[model samples]
Target: MALFAVLSGLSACGLPRSGPTKGEIRAGSVEEQGDTFIVPVTAQVARATAMVPPLGFTNGFLGAGVIGSDVIRPGDVLGLTIWENVDNGLLAGPGMNSTALQEMQVDGDGFIFVPYAGRIQAAGNTPEALRRIITEKLDAQTPDPQVTVARIAGDGATVSVMGGVGGQGVYPIERPTRTLSAMLAKAGGVIIEPEIAQIVVTRGHHTGRVWLKDLYSNPQFDVALRPGDVILVEKDQRNFTAIGATGAQNRVHFETQELSAIEAIAQVGGLSTNAADPTGVFVLRDEDPATANTVLGRTDLIGPQRVAYVLDLTEPSGLFNARDFMIRDGDTVYVTEAPYTRWQKLLGALTGAAGSANSLSKAAGN
Candidate 1:
């Protein structure tokens, strides 16, 4: 009876097994004990949906009108003009001279000394406000004194632009209507492989990200610039590893731009014909350990989930919109080969048997 049972099990190999079908395999399913199975179809779908790139602005503080404000700092050269009752004439030029009747340079104490005015605070005040203050000081000595203050050297209006831009440096904010794009243009636009969507603006201790596409497309995404604002255009080239059946196995640079899964695959030279498993194409995203630990420790605030996504490209439908899957900064993509790829040696034997069977059948009929 035991021998018969063993033979029955061996014969069952040729028969169809009571398990998942081809559809189930394509849908991402694994057979478990007995008739039970574990299928991550819903999870896979959710992951694919989550992998969709964020469409709009991702960073920076953009709102109506200007927030905070730029202030004057030390080491700035101010062009001072003074009108001395039409007798002293209109004094306008660079630097301070005896005939010029104007003062320049703010002391270490943030004070500028002018003729008739002993010491005045010029730093941290706008040019217009400084003009009014200088006028009031001169008015104490002369009647109806007219004073004008212009920044000769923009050392005071300092702003730092970094990341992705061709030129990253500390530039002067000459105009009040300067926008983010203007700053980038001054820095020579973005460098190669730039993340066009991820731009970060850091002011004091606060930092925010802005999406370039949204900033240009949506009028509401415009934000006024303030002095001392550090604009950092960071590339999102996190720690992404491309492996499996690609033409080249390489790491991608993630700047302030959006990278789709298809693009990432192409960057490595597409898939290798001999080793690629089209159905097993997937991405593994590691959960941010720091964020996950913080969320687990703090229960009061709404914490993010520690989860990753796996993408599959075996389905014919997935090819239609493959670009929609945005590859995160640090993700790993693996392509597997089909299991039946190693069975090519058996094809000749099978072909010969089929031919012989057909010949025998034809001979019998004749």
Candidate 2:
């Protein structure tokens, strides 16, 4: 009776489990509360979910023409030099024939104060335009007045670049740095990996974003930048959690701009060979109402719904379908253990119990 009790206790001991079984997962779904949704990964589902809105520059950013780099702004500084034909003219003094006025900052109201020219609007006008205006004003006082205006450094036609960039500072918009990609290069390029790099451009109230690689691949994404534009180069924050019977379960970041389900699985070292159930691989995520309805082909669900997408690798077209399926951010990839694994554990326990019983019999005989 004691030997039988020992064998029964060993067989009934709780077995260690990597994750819930396939049948258990299906049974755990709550229809009323919308806790878990089990949906098979079909061709239609893959195509539907792949229709997520892509990020890029919109018409507001794309349609705007490139701004003139030579144009002056309110915060710009100017160096004015006045050369008069006569030796003691209005600007020049004594034996001096020319007068140099350096570091003339344009005021907030877009005006710069000159001795003879009074208050001149220098913000909208270029250096040459300012020269003509100053020459006209000083001509009455000094005969044949010659004026030259040179733009110095300031906040005019500039952008603020920060975050994950080689150089973080205010960059002036020059001829070579007029567009989004050009400005990124002006900032010494992105510091993070290009594949996972994302560029965000904020102009006024509007904001646009695109992958760093897309700037070259898609020319339309390289939109013209405006003054006061704030650009940020950052690494992709999108990542998924891998658990259950995978090679190494952890939070895996996206390696590329667009990650497919197969690629996501491979990044986590693929499914566990020994214990993984090929038909039980699941990708779990919280789907928005629209996406949830589309995937389940039902309209009763509302708000964010819990969805578990099952992928059967044993199918004939499983690999191809998985390659087409897209994995989103904050998703969980779970691979349930095979049914035979639990039975194997039970058999191993029974063998160990039998070995203990045989040892007791040997000791009694001795």
Local error of candidate 1 at residue 190 (angstroms): 4.5
Model 2 over residues 1-366: C-alpha lDDT tens digits?
875675557646766778788887888676544479888898988998886457798899989998898788988878899899997787788999999999898999899999987999998888888899989988888799888998765777788999999899887777778898888888888899988889999999989988888888998888888888999988898999999889998998888877888898899898888888889989998888898988888888889988889999999988888888899989899999887776676667878768999999999999
- Please give, for residues 1-366, the per-residue lDDT of candidate 1 as tens digits: 864564454444442222222343344422222221222223334343443345433344554355323455676667777766644432423343213434376767788888777688988898889888888877777667777777653445557888778888876665643677777787887673433446677767877665666566666556666667788775453556887667777786654365677777877888777656666666655434443334234334333332333445666556534466666766776665444442332343445657999999999999
Per-model lDDT: 0.59, 0.86
Cα deviation in Å at residue 306, candidate 2? 1.5
Candidate 2: worst 10 consecutive residues by lDDT?
Answer: 3-12
Off by over 4 Å in 2: 1-13, 30-34, 79-104, 112-121, 131-153, 347-366
Which pairs clash (backbone N, Cα, C closer than 3 Å) in model 2? none
Considering summed lDDT, which 10 consecutive residues are worst modelled in model 1?
Answer: 32-41
Candidate 1: how large is its RMSD?
A: 11.2
Q: What is residue 108's positional error in candidate 2, in angstroms?
A: 1.9
